[model samples]
Target: MELQRLRDVFRTALDLPADAPVDDLHYQDHEKWDSLAHMSLIAALEDEFDVMIDTEDVINMSSFGEATRILGKYGVDFNG
Candidate 1:
């Protein structure tokens, strides 16, 4: 599940590389992840996880690592 989430995040957030390092993800650290991309990312994540992320979380999600942590709060177990 974690791997799938990571992959989805990467595919949605273009700032990340094909093989992005999950431990070092950040939004402002890349060019492709602009405002539009972030919106797309949120949509993708919501569809993939089948959860409606809050607006605050959408704004606060600035990295893959941050996303993982935030989603975990919503019962997305990474251990899977």
Candidate 2:
């Protein structure tokens, strides 16, 4: 559920299609995931997860999987 929500957030922020595979997405790799989109993604993630992401984590969140791991640090459980 949480994972799906994360994917949804990614889709919305990056303007990706519903079926777009976000798991392997990386910043700058996707045309839509520019610096502006990165900040938007961070804000969306913060709002969706109800957690404040720090600068280091923001910089570290270069990929979808990395974002999941960072959110885990904020107690956003991904395990079923």
Worst 10 residues of 1 by lDDT: 15-24
lDDT by residue for model 1 (1-80), tens = 67576675666556555666555657757667778888988887787778899999999998888888888887788877
| lDDT of every model, 2 decimals | 0.76, 0.98
User: Over all chains combined, what TM-score does candidate 1 have?
Assistant: 0.79
Off by over 4 Å in 1: 13-17, 20-23
lDDT of 2 by residue, 17-52 (tens): 999999999999999999999999999999999999
* Cα-based lDDT at residue 48, candidate 1: 76
Rate residue 35 of model 2 by lDDT: 99
TM-score to native of every candidate shown: 0.79, 0.97
At residue 14, give the lDDT of candidate 1: 67
Tell me the lDDT of model 2 at 3: 99
Clash totals for all models, in order? 0, 0
